[model samples]
Target: MKLINWWPPMLGTGISLKKVSKDMTTFEVIMKLRWYNRNLVGIHYGGSLYSMCDPWYMFILMANLGKGYVVMDKAAAIRYKKPGRGTLKCVFHISKSEIKEIRSEIDMIGKKDYTFTCEVMDEEGEVVTEVDKVVYVRKKDFDFEALEKEKEAGNTKIPG
Candidate 1:
């Protein structure tokens, strides 16, 4: 499914895409804390905090890169800076130059992997969570026929 469709699930969990630019390279998504989203201490649940961070950067990259390339959130490491009490917002931004630089690096290295960083900030504009995300990108020349066959045979699960 398209990435935009994910908005529903995010919203269902109190996350809202407040603003998405026309280019869709930068976006502001907010997650409000409801009673259900609170932990025993009545702060934002850690799992929900992590969940709110789940998709912004990857979506930004995909929308910026168009279609020839594929981007995935291969791995993520989040460092929570402080307790979240009120509403939370994560602003994700990817520029053309950044995307171009990534492409150039991949072209020079052939099929390989790369990583980028994104941050989720609180109302104070302080980073509440810092995320290090790794993305595995491969070129069309890379041998994938066998892998595709395996996927067709239900032996592999490729990231969408």
Candidate 2:
């Protein structure tokens, strides 16, 4: 939370993660409609709304799936349902059972693309944006121990 609060893109756009569950399966991000983050028409910028929804599912998957799997966002789509105003929030959550299902599917198929949908809402709880993210997960064939050693040696970076 401390490190991510300083993330440049989020900080620049006024988007901030408000809270995260202890297990990292649930979190909330919020953005207040400010001069810098508004669209020309005086609503939340599409990019900011989308940004609040991005990367979260992948982050959750990576946390739950361990080091033996690859998790990345494969694609995404966003729709502006209504003009957002004031403080807008997006709540991200995926159940443990759902994660287990995804793992089971990946174990059987070797890889899978899982799509999850979430909404960005206004203070009144009316949806302002709808986003569907496709996350890709696959088993890794490489040695996790070797990767860890390389990471400790400061010589390798893993891609999400």
Which candidate wins on TM-score? 2
Pick by lDDT: which candidate is best?
Answer: 2
Question: In candidate 1, what are the lDDT values of residues 76-159, reduced to their tens digit?
Answer: 777888888788888777787877776765544444556667777777888777777777765555456766677689886443
Question: How large an RMSD does model 2 have?
Answer: 8.9
lDDT of 2 at 45: 87
lDDT of 2 at 10: 88
lDDT of 2 at 153: 98
Model 2, residue 12: distance off in Å is 1.0
- Lowest-sum lDDT 10-residue window in model 2: 141-150
